[model samples]
Each structure stands twice: as structure tokens, then as C-alpha cells.
Target: MTLSAQLGIIVGYLVLALLIGLSAYRLTDRTAADFYLASRTLGTVVLLSTTFATLLSAFTFFAGPNIAYHEGPEWILVMGLMDGIIFAILWYVIGYKQWLLGQQYDYVTLGEMLGDRFGSGLLRGLIAAVSLLWLFPYVMLQQVGAGTALETLTDGAIPYWAGAGLITAFMILYVVLAGMRGIAWTDTLQGAFMLVVTWVAMLWLLTAIGGPTSATAALETEAAAHVALGSDHYTPQWMLSRALVIGFGVAMFPQVNQRFFAAGSRTVLKRSFALWPILCVLLFVPSFMIGAWAHGLDVTVPADGNVLPIVLTEFTPGWFAALVIAGAMAAMMSSSDSMLLSGSSYFTRDLYRPLAEFSSRDVSERREDLLARVGVVVFATAAFLVSLVNPATLFELGDAAFSGFAQLALPVLAALYWRRTTRAGIGAGILLSQTFYLLSHFTTVVPGTYAGWTAGVVGMALGLGATVGVSLVTTPAAAERRALYFDGNETGAE
Candidate 1:
């Protein structure tokens, strides 16, 4: 495959994506539901595809392979396998309930639901602000992955900044123009392409090395530490622990919550949850192979993270390579658009709207809409800028944010089921927990804060304690407390 031909195919795929977005524009453009939740009419197929697409992003495609290439097979084969199943089980247990509530409340975003549940303006704003802050680093990591892939695939013909700019421009136009419908519809197409290309790439690489048996043998000899399970630093316990974090944390991701809200109904959402683990197997396993294969073939590069793209370009023919590049871009764009929309929704519903005292008819409502649209551009631009300056792996930044949110999992669960949990306690606990988690992340001076998830656990523990203890000490407000906790009417108990 010549470079020109590869570029041509890539452009053709982009055009197809744009057409899908344009076609879905009318479906998503009309009202609040249409814009934010795809009119609450998404079926099972669309929900499944969009869910998988949202999960399989730059980190999964590029970074997972890179981890396998560098660390060993345990990181992907063992750890990743556990992650898929665990995530599915967690979703089955709690996710359906959230979906049911979302339908009952006509919820458009996670912050909206949380605000209603807590019955506090300040807590909602805090949660929204924290979500936005954490999301920026996650988005920045995605932009970095995409820019690196484009630059390396095109051999620096497109610089990192230029690559970031191109993707951001396309996403902004795609997301703002059609909203959730455009994002989901385009994701359906991209997710399909990426899955097909992944299998093709795997088969091609296997064939390139003669057969699976021979390839395994070759990898065992050449990259013994990386190819074999439990080799090097790959222990079963460590792998299982890592998998737990990844699996559980995925649910706590704000982007995934937004996806849950995007579904039309509980049935569609439940089906998507059940199917996502299988989708994870399809996308994540092959990426692991790409890494191990790259290692066996001795295809070393300056940046280990580029191993996936480098392998795609090396093992596959020109046209196939072009398709692979397009698939990678698809992954990047799918996740990016979801994050942009999720972050913007936080700005609109949680911060701006609440400050207006939940009134949709206020003068500030129009300004808030404008602010959200503007936020889409500003957030995307910040991501691009951060990627250009310091390139970090998507997986690392994602895990950091994941761990941060996982701390809130306890509080969220408590808030949902425990009526005795007071707003003051919930608010104070989150503040303490998140603060401890950050201090643990940034500074090593404090002992016992070194365990990454441990920080979240401790923080959440203290926060929960404070919430329960404080509520016991102080009397709950008669009107608001009863309305919020007793009747299960976070949306005014109608």
C-alpha cells in the first residue's frame, strides 16, 4: 500500500462517517431529549454498538497492545479477560436500576440525577466541576493517542498538533451538529469497522508468522517474557487486582454514565450491558495479540505505544493498512465525542441550570445553552493543547480518573439506597475523600496514601462515615429531606 492510497482510503472512511452524522442530524436536532438522549428511542442494536464503541477507544486499541508488548501476556490475557466479565456482572446488578430511574425521571445526564437525589445545589455543582476537571485529562490522553498514531502512520507527514486539530474539528462539527444521535449512529458504523479490522489484522499477523502454533512458538522464543502468561512481572494476583479496578471503574466513568442515559429505555440499556462484555472480547483480545506479535517480530520503535499501528502497517497490505488506520481513528473519535458531550452536559444541567434554580424559562437558560455549545469547543481545544505539550498514555490517565471516581462509587451507592444519608454528610465525605485521593496521587510525602485505589477506598470510607454520623447527630429537614429520601422523588416526588 502506497502512502497516497492509504490516505485516500482514510479520507473515504471519514467521508462515510460524516455522511452518517449528517443523516442523523434531523433525528437529534429538535429538542432536549433528542439532543442529549437521542430522543429516548434508541433500540438494542444501536445501544449495543454505541456502548461498545464508547468503550473501545484509543486506550483499548493502542495502549492495551502496547502494554502486552512491554509487560507480558498476563496484563492483557488474564487481567483483561477478568475485566470483561466483572464489568458485565456489575452492570447486570446495578446498571438496570439506574436505567429504570433514568426513564422515570426523564434524566439527560448523571449530574442531573445526582443533584435531584442530593437535593443540594452546592453538591451538584461540586460534582459537576470535579467531573469536568477529571474529564479534561482523559480527553487529552485520547487526543495524544490519535495524534501519535496519525503522525507515525503517515511518517510525520502530519505533525502531532495538526493531527489533533483535524480530529477535534471533525468531532466538534459532528457532536454539536447532531448531538447524541449523530454520535451513536456514527459509532455504530465505526464500531463495526473496527471489529472487522481487528479480526483481519489478527488473522493476517498469524498467517504472516506461518500459523497460530508456529507463531506462539516463535513468540515464546523471541519475546518469552511478553508472550507467556505469569512470566516476568505478570503475577496472577496482581493481574486480578488490576482487572478489578479496570472492570469496576469503567462503570464509574462519567462517559459510560452518559451512555446509559443516552439509551431509549431500560430494555435497550440492559441489552447493551449484557452484550458489552462480548464486544470487549472481540476488540480487546486482538489488540493484545497485536502487541505480542509486534514483540515476536522484533519490531521495536522509539515509542512502545505505537506498536499497534506499526504492526498494522508492517504485517497487512496497503489497503488493509489504510482500513486499520481508519479503524483506529474511529475508536478515537467515538470516545472523544462522548466525552465532549458528557462534559458539556455537566456544564449545562448541573452548574448553569442549577444556578438558575432549575428554571428552564429563565433568561439564563438561553445563555446556558450557548455556554454549553461554547464549552464543547473550549473543552476540545484544551484537550488538543494538552496533547501537543505533554504526551501521556491514554490508559494511565484513564486509570487515574477511574480510581478517582471509583471513590465516589460508595457515596453514589449509599445515596441511592440509604435514605438516612444526609446531604451535608454526602457533600463533606466526597470533599474529604477526593482531596485525600489527589494528595495521594500527587505527593509521595504522605505515607499510606500510596495505594492508588486504596486512597479512594479510605476517602470514601471517611466520607460515608461522616455522612452517616453527621445525619445521626443533626435533624434532617422536614420538607426537603422527606421529599428527597423518603418518597424516592428526587425529581420532586410527583
Candidate 2:
């Protein structure tokens, strides 16, 4: 196929997405609840689809296969089996609780929920700041992946900036257009599109290479190190760290955490969690297998290039390859739009609204919604600018974002279950743990990982310990404040 024809396929996909976004806008009201939480109307299908698509980003589309291609297929253990189960359990433990509270209190963002419970505006702003800060890299990562993927597939016809900008522009439009309602619908479309394309690419590659049996034989004969697991990269320490970082960390991401509030009912949330592991295997198993098979072929891959794109172009037709590339873009776009939408909520509600009130200026819901939309555009532009830097590999940037968000998990857990958890305790936990995690990553003041401990593990341990110990020493929150979250008379009350 000609370059124009291949590009046309991608263009058509974008137009379809735009149409979806527009259609979703028709169903929406201008309220913050409608914009951010879809009016709490998500059913199991849309809830599961949106959550899955939002979490499956450039990291999964590119870095996942890239790892399996270079390392062994043991990545399946971390990303597929362990993360699938762990995140599902977290959904029930954290998400279900949040949903129950949200149903009664109409809580939208994690910061709002925590801040209200602790009766601390500073804590709300701080949590929101941390969320927005870590979200920037992950958002930039999607743009970087989109740009790099386009550059690779066109064999450099498309410059990196153009590709990155294209997606960023579209993502900003989607969030600003329809908000969560539109994004969720579009996410469902994108999720199914990418999942099928991945399976097709894997099957085609296996057919061209004779079969999985043949691929395995080739892997054993050549690149035998990767054919087997438990070597350099798949050490117990690294593997466990990946699972811990990805599983716990991902659940607390502003985007993913927002979904916890969006669930229409406990049944919808329950079904989504129940089916998540199957979705995990369906996506990760094929993606990682493609990478492992690519290792056996030892296909010539460019510097910092994704092997899946190279292998697809080699074995598949140009149009099919173009379609598959669009699939990768689907994953990136879905995740980016969610990030922008969620970040906007944090900014306007947790950050901007509080500052406005501090000045004795009340923010109306209409004004708040407008500010949130503005936040989306501004943040998208910022991410696009950062994407051009090429700071690190997809995995490195992703792992950093994951580890950063993981620090929130422990403090949040303490808040939900322990009524004795004080504002002082939670505040200390957030500050000290986040400070340590940042130092470990940015300054090398501390090692990012030691032995089997990723920065996230170290951070979470410190956070939990601080929360428990401080809560013991400090005064508990007022009795009335605790009743809203935990009534001793209520069954199953914390």
C-alpha cells in the first residue's frame, strides 16, 4: 500500500473517534458530576471496557512486547497473572468501599474524599498535587509512544513531533468535548479494536514463522537465554517489584481511582473485577508472546524501536500493518484522554476550588466545570511539550509513574479501614513517604530499589508504618467526622 493509503486508514480511525466523542457530548449535561463521573451511570460492560482501556497504555502496547522480545516470557507472570489478580482484589477492597461512600456522599475524586474525611484542605491540595505531578509523565509517555510508533512505521516519514502532537490534540479535543461520558464510550471502542488487532498480529506472525511450536524451537536453538525464564531480568526480586509497582500503583492512579466512583452499583464493579483477569491474559499473553517470538527471529530492530512494529511490517500486508498501528494508537489515546479528564477534576476541585474559597470566592458548578475543561487543554499542551524530550524508554517512564502512584495506596488504605487514622497521621504518611519516593527517583539520595524492593515497596512500607504508628500517638479525628465514613452501628462499618 502507498504511504497515503496507509495514512488514510489511520485518518479514518481518528474521524470515527471524533464522531464518537461528539455523540457522547449529546448525552451529557454540563454538571461536574456528568463531566467527571458520567453521573455515576456506568454499567458493567462500559465500566469494564473503560477501565481496561484506560490502564492499557503505551507501556503495554510497546514496552510489554519489547521486554518479552529482549527478556524472557516470564513477564507474563508479573503483568498477566499477578497484576490481574492483585488489581481485582484491590478493586473490591478500595474501589467497592469508595463506591459505597460515593453513593451516599457523591464523592468524585480521591482527594475530595480523603480531604473531607480528614477535614483538611491542605491534605486535599497535597494529594491532588501529587496526583497531577505523577500523571504528567504517564500522559507524556502516551504521546511519546504515539510519535515514536508513527515514526517507526512510516520508516521516518512522520517526524516524532507531528505524531505526538496529533494524538495530544485529539485527546484534548475528546476530553474538552464530552468529558467522561464520551471518553468512556470511546474507550470501549478503542479497547475492543486493540484487543482484536493484537490477537491477529500474533496469529499472523506465528503462521509466517510456521507455528508456536516452530517459534519455540527457534527460540531454544537461538537466543536460548530468553527462551527460558529466571535469568538476569526475570530474577525474583525484579519480577516481584514489577508486580508490586504495577498492581498496587495502577489501582490508585487518578484516572483508575475515578472509575471506582463511576461504577453504577456494586454489582457492576463486582462483575468488572471478576472479568479483569481474563482480559489481562487475553491481552498480555499474546503481546508478550509476540515479543518472545521476535527474539527467536532476531529481526533487525532499529535503536529504541519496538520489535512488534518491525515484525508486523515484515510479515503482514501494509494495510493490515497500518490497522494494527492504529490499534496501538487506540491504547495510547484511551489512556491519555482518561488522564486528562481525571487530572482536570483534581485541578479544579482539589486545587483551584480550595484556593478560590480561601480568598472567600465561591466557585459555582458551571465555573468549576469550565475551569476543569481549561485544565485539560493546558495539561495536554504541557504533556506534548514534555514528550519531545525523549527522557527515557517507555518502561522506565511508566515504572516511575507507577511507583510514584503506588505510594498513595497505603495511606489511602489506612484512611478507609482505620477510624483512628488521624489527619496528622495521614498527613505525615503522605509527606514523608512521598518525599522519600521522590528522592529515591530524582536525586539518588536513596536507592530506587534494593534487594527485591522497588521504590514503591519501600515507599508503601514506610507509609503504612508511619500511618499506623502516628495514628496511635496522635489524637484521632473528631467522633462526628468519623461517623460519616464509619458508623459503629452500621453493619460491616470500619
Candidate 3:
């Protein structure tokens, strides 16, 4: 009966998602711009919700709580409070400028803008490559979360592989069918569902576990460390580093950056960002508290740190538990679909379009759309295979993904604001930073002694240094090009 209830809830949720996709498909036009970017028609609400939903991924749903369960509530401080402010600032700083440029130039991808700015196919390819490297792992994290959630919810009745496949299949169908329009619409719905279910589940759990006061009291008595913040793991430097990396890195994610192109206007973008911090507080506080509460509960946390399902099954009724599981699944699928779409867009717009003999203007829009859909399938399948391996904890995988993308922050900023930024300099910065980060991952060069400082931070600093130093020695971009981006009142230079 329990298994049937759980299956029914999941199937029902997926059907709703499919219907939303079909609706989006019905409205979608055949143009590449319309297919890839929703014709830049997203309003304030859908823009905010889709970006919020895409940003808060399986990592937040599963790994965040898992970290809090073991490490204490400091995870909330690292991501919930600090990350909220950090990303909000970035949204204002990077997003507005990107939207302005995208509006004037009709750019659908970040790589396209950067490549045109620098006139370097190498730079374009580099950005796309780095994005894919980080994006692949992040997408795999969603699959892992989905598989683990279902496996735990059904008590092994549904295997991990089956769970992962189910999400992959649904995501592929919806994304390929409707593209960005479908993704945004579905994301808005999923985002709202996630917020409501998570809050309700948290309130219900708190009440059942003798309220917040009782939970904290139990934690203090049984595991005082879980309530406090003196662990060797979280240092001031470490926390600050995490805040910076995630703040800058998340802003540059291909999927998130593409949303800049999807916004109807600057007003819509601003309105969405204004509401982001509040949403963060609502969603993350409860999630981390749930994990902290689980530390004090009688339940045994799983080895994989998938405590959400265990808590839901043990504390909540089967029906409520199933719905909450669906919410979690919603978070995973929303993020996965966005990432898959962005990855395909990067390949199609940045990589293939440049190298292909056929002019994009000359080619049929249907052919281009078909190619993008194929890329989506290929990328999703690869990510699914990686999820089967289950390489690391969700937190660790998320950290790696953030680190790789964060390295691009310096280069991206330079391209936007620093007219003196040369192609060689930007290329040097990206290559050096990524190389350093990769080496640090494999080697003991960057000791784990510091709390928030990782190889990624070190690499970012090096990349920034390299960019500045190289730009000094190299020729600056043309005055016309500089004027195009930086000159007041002008949209862009033709």
C-alpha cells in the first residue's frame, strides 16, 4: 500500500510536468531564438521562479541537509544567508549588463558574446568546454539525488538505476519538446511546489519532533557540537571563500546566464533578483533545520547522507511523505532540465555553429532545433551514465562544479568592463586557472588545512593575476569595440 501510494504520487507529479511541457510545445515557435530562449518573453514571476528553481538544485534538496546533519547548522550560514546576499549582488552586477548586451545583440549564449567581444574562437570554445565540464557533474548530481530519493522512499523496491532513468527520460522528453519555454514554465510550477511542500514538511516534522525548541534541546544534550559552530571544518576563511566562490560561480553558470537572455526586460530581471533573498531564507532555513533536527532524532541517517527520505518516511504520514518526495524530485528535474538545455545550447551556438559550413541564417530553423535536441540527448545520456558510477557526495560534487565555473568570473568580468582585456590575456587567465584547479584536485598542492579555501580560490587568484599581467603586455581591444559595450547611451556598435 505504501509503495503504491508513493508510486501514485510520483507518477501524478511527472504527468503534470509532461502536460506543462506539451502546453509549452504548443505555444513554441520554430525559430532558433524562440526555441532556445523563449523569444525573450519571460516575465518577472516566471523569470524569478525558473532562475531560483534552477539555482537551487538536487544539491540543496539532498546534500545541503546531509551536510547539516553531520557538520551542524553552519551549512545554512554558508549557503542560505551568505549565498543569498552574494548572488543577489551578482545578479545586479552581472545580470543587468548581460541583459543589456543580449537585448542589443540578440546573443543566446554567453560564449557567443565573449567570442564576438574577443574575436577568438578559442575563447568561445574554452568557455563552452569549461561550462560542460562543470555542468556534467552538476547534472549527474541531480540523477544521483533522484535515484537515491526513490530508492529510499520505496525502501529498495525501486532501484537507483531505474530511478535515474525515469528522471532522465522525462527531462529529455520535455526539454526536447518545448525547449526554454517549456523549461521556464515547468520550472515555475516546480519551484512553487518545492517551496510549499518543503515548508509544510518542515513544519509538520518540527511539530511531531516536539517543536523547534525540543529539537534544539535534544541536539544540545545529545550532540552539542551539532548546534554550535566550533568544528575544525568551518573556519571564517573557509566560509568566506565558499560564499565568494558560489556567489560568483553560480552567476556564470551557462543555464543561469542564459536566463539573462530570456528576461523580457531589465525591469523583470531586477524584480526577480529583489525577491531572491527572501525566497532563499524561506527554502534553505527549513532544509538545514530539518537536517539539524535529524541529528537529534532516533532515526539512523543513511550512509549516503540521504536523510530527507528517512525523516519523511518515519515522521510524516505516507501520503505527505510521498508528496514531499515528489517535491524533492521536482527540484532535481527542474535543475536537470535547465542544465541539459543550456549544455545543448552551448554546443549548438558556441561550438558547432562556428565550425559548421552552413550559415545559421541560411539553414532551416527546424534543422538547427533538431541539432540542439540531439545534443540534449547526448549530454543527458552521458550524465546518466556518470550518475550510475556515483562518484562522490552531493556536496563534494557541487563544490567541484562551483569551483570550475567560478574560475571564469574574473575573465567574464574583464570582458564586460575592462576594455583593455586582450584575447590572449583572457585565454591565459582561463587556461591557467582551470589547469591549476585540475592539478589541485589530483594533487596535495592546496592543503585542506583552511576551512573555505580550496584550489579553486587559488586558481581564481592566479587567473586574475595572469589576466592583468598579460593584458598589460598585449594590445587592448579596438576603441570601436570598447565603445560598443562601455559607452553610455549606445546599445551596441554595428
Q: TM-score: which candidate is best?
A: 2
- Predicted structure 3, TM vs. truth: 0.95
Residue 432 in model 1: lDDT: 75
Ranking by lDDT: 2, 3, 1
Cα lDDT of model 3 by residue, 232-311, tens digit: 77777787777777878898889898988889987898788788778989999998789878988898986785988889
Q: Give the candidate number with the greatest lDDT.
A: 2
Lowest summed lDDT window (length 10), candidate 2: 476-485
Candidate 1 lDDT by residue in tens digits, 5-117: 87788777877898888888865455667777787777888877877788777777777787777765555564346446876765655466567667778777766776777
Which candidate would rank higher by TM-score, 1 or 2? 2
Give Cα-based local distance difference scores for all models: 0.72, 0.88, 0.84
Q: How do these models rank on TM-score, best leading?
A: 2, 3, 1
lDDT of 3 at 169: 93
Native-to-model Cα distance after best TM-score fit, residue 466 in candidate 2, in Å: 0.9
Q: RMSDs, each prediction?
A: 3.5, 1.5, 2.7
Cα error, residue 347 of model 3, in Å, equals: 0.2
Clashing pairs in 2: none
Q: Give the TM-score of candidate 1.
A: 0.90
Q: How far in Å is the alpha carbon of 239 misplaced in model 3?
A: 1.3
